[model samples]
Target: MNLVTPPEHPFAQFVRILGKGKRGARNLSREEARDAMGMLLDGKVEESQLGAFLMLLRHKEESAEEMAGFTEAVRARLQTPAIAVDLDWPSYAGKKRHLPWFLLAAKALANSGVRILLHGGGAHTAGRLYSEQLLETLDIRLCRDWQQVEKALDQQQLAFIPLGDWMPPLQHMIDLRNILGLRSPIHSLARILNPLNARCGLQSIFHPGYQAVHREASQLLGDTAVVIKGEGGEIEINPDASSHLYGTANGVNWDEEWPALAAMRHVKPASLIPEHLLACWRGEASDAYGQLAIISTMALALRGLGEPRDTAINRAEALWASRHQVART
Candidate 1:
């Protein structure tokens, strides 16, 4: 296969370079990865070729430089809304067993004067579903257009952008992973991709193994991101008082169980599933999980946005109390 021919277009060139690889995995140089990603975001690569490139990248695994380069390429294609605060939260893409709290976290942060943007979908084959479904239950509509996303932030200080709506090609790449019956490199890359020039970000991680990757990538990217090993990959700390909750920014770090704040008590766990939780929100049924999700997520959001430990605990208690009364009535 010829790797040096200049095709008629950048995308075609990308297809030629990436398609030259065999069916199995292959390591990619930083330049190759960047060129391929640039072609992808520029709409230069054909759909089939793009799918092949993604699969190849998955089997090979992405290095920090490659991931960073790919992220830059993707961001160039994004139409970011002009919000007062450049806040971002990347959902880790798999959360079926436990309840989702990121939606609640976004809402609570928005309520407390923080500008927030959340991105995710509902096509997890193994997991129960994504966070998009939970937001729908809260009456928060997904913004389809980048302009509308900006407008939502300008007007309401909160916006949710489904990957399908914001970037179809990238979503197509993610969908291809489903064909393999497991997650692909895109899954990990998506968690670290911050499209907007957001100075503050709340990033969630699923497995502990990815902590070094996230930390290294965040450091290299030099963004102010708080990495959380939240519940089921959502940005909520475990309420058992046993799990260690950590947040890091600019080399400074803090945890919920630090010696300075060891007096905090664990919140009670919720017992309902995602669908039933929504029903409970609508007053059509009772959902312990929904209520717990709201409380725990709100607390974590407060902490993520720089709220003092005591204040976060107090705010969570107050919000839970208010919601409980409403549910009773």
Candidate 2:
């Protein structure tokens, strides 16, 4: 008997049945994961079936092999641009609470000659505008075409691609999350997919629970990446001085000495986060904290900015300090 055979109906039919709770909650084999992802990415899966598939996968939780297989299917569908930069940052959902700092990080990296590609979609909620909106606030427009992105990278060392253009199917999956009012497996997958040929990426996750999922996903990637626990899901290092875990292609590194809030002698309360400071950072007005956050995250990135840890940190501090003079001017 041939053990390997396609399902009797369309793959979407099988997906709909599997998603409808017909199949007991169980881990998907590697092949099953690949086929499901392929159908979703190709737009062959119906909206209802899509929701079911996503929810089921979330409950079952993706294993490393399953994630790798699913990502491989996603990678196959994405039109990755050939850029020379080694690092790309893919920001995830939710950024309403804290000041958006990834823009500053991207700008600083661009200013320092690191080719950075940033990508994300618009606000799923009324209160939360996304990184793309924040970038627009800074006069940075999203580049929809691969050639245009390459041109921007060659000229300014930075480019932003909107999800609707860079990966529509993935965006479609993300849209479903909003409708369901629950995050799906695509949320995790989106954070890990690097759409550039570059071999290194910087990814940030907001929830601690997802850290292991990111780690497992990163192993499927051919390039080196650092997974950071970020503020409001943006990749900027936490300004509250929380311990951050940095997972690279080789292994994981933890910052043990990160200052805790209670230990700090002088710290601003979350209620006291200055609006003028945020506006200035957002370019709606001029303020200092935004500038400080930008400088600090840039320094952090520079410390591990593709060099030996010590050298990167030393250089990052020096570079950060140098910006203070400009802030005065």
Candidate 3:
């Protein structure tokens, strides 16, 4: 007796399109990628197909078109409000070696009237200190939805939203790190989401070659963004070493080198202390490395927002110096 072949699952086509033999496989077109991501976000894809699709894409590193397409699908479903956001800061990569000095930098900028939205996936990886956990200590509000986001941004010029709250599907994928034994493209896609369409998007990559990918992807998405190899992959500029900034603005792509803020490399702190961030901001602590990290990271964001190099650095320094006064007012 002969058996009839069953019809293929609709989502299986996407998995096949990506996982076909080396000779047959190819990157998906922007339209295909957008459709695939839409299905994933809508929970239409099955578990087996979902794993295969993501891992196949991961094996062959996602392209700018893929990233841009994925970002489009995500933004389409996002319920972003009309609130004007100056900076889109995604902090998915939790810090391990250093306290999240960038948080302090963001607080200073927010205090000085720069409306910023910081979103992150909860700490999926072990032994890292994520932004969401430390927000209370820093006195920044952790918002759960657009309503809270709008209120926080209006009240304090800053808001921190976790991925699980805004986009549960992406956060689910991030949490699958242990099961998959490798990170999916969701990590990179999350960084470029910029759900609020902020004028300036800040992205960081731990791996090399992704900077260019992020730059091209941001250009494709028509985003003014800066891509950096942040310290511990958290967008915090390391004071001990020179760093390169790859970015796009007004549809133009550019790169620049920033000198080390410290004369010599400083050893990593013995431990990451959460309270130190607030203490530094309150002018109760003096940490040369931490202070320089905050100013340099702020300057990078300011430059991404169209400030001149020297002027951005000067402005960041001034912002840090007067953070207490900004808070009081």
Candidate 2: worst 10 consecutive residues by lDDT?
320-329
Q: Write the per-residue lDDT of candidate 3 for residues 137-166, one digit (tens) a residue.
A: 999999888999999988899999898998
Which clashing pairs does model 2 show?
280-285, 303-312, 303-313
Report the lDDT tens digits of candidate 1 across residue range 1-329: 86886657555554454446576334455566667787777677677666666665555556767776777777777776555565777764656555665565466556555677777754665545576666667755578877877777766667878887877777767787667655767777777776676666666677765655565666666766666666677666555434445556676655555221224444434443666655554457754545555666666666666777678878875764544232210
lDDT, residue 294, model 3: 95
What TM-score would every model get versus the actual structure? 0.74, 0.80, 0.97
Candidate closest to the true structure, highest TM-score: 3
Q: Higher-TM-score candidate among 1 and 3?
A: 3
lDDT of 1 at 263: 42
Which residue pairs of candidate 1 clash? 11-44, 96-128
Candidate 3 lDDT: 0.91
Sort all candidates by lDDT, best to worst. 3, 2, 1
For candidate 2, lDDT tens digit of each residue in 1-329?
77987765466654544455645545666677788788878877667777777776776666766777787887888766566865677766756666676576666566566777777765655566477655655655579788888887787777888777877888777777668888777777777777785556676777666765676566655546666677667777655566455555555443323343323323433642334434554456643444555655675565444565456545554654453232210
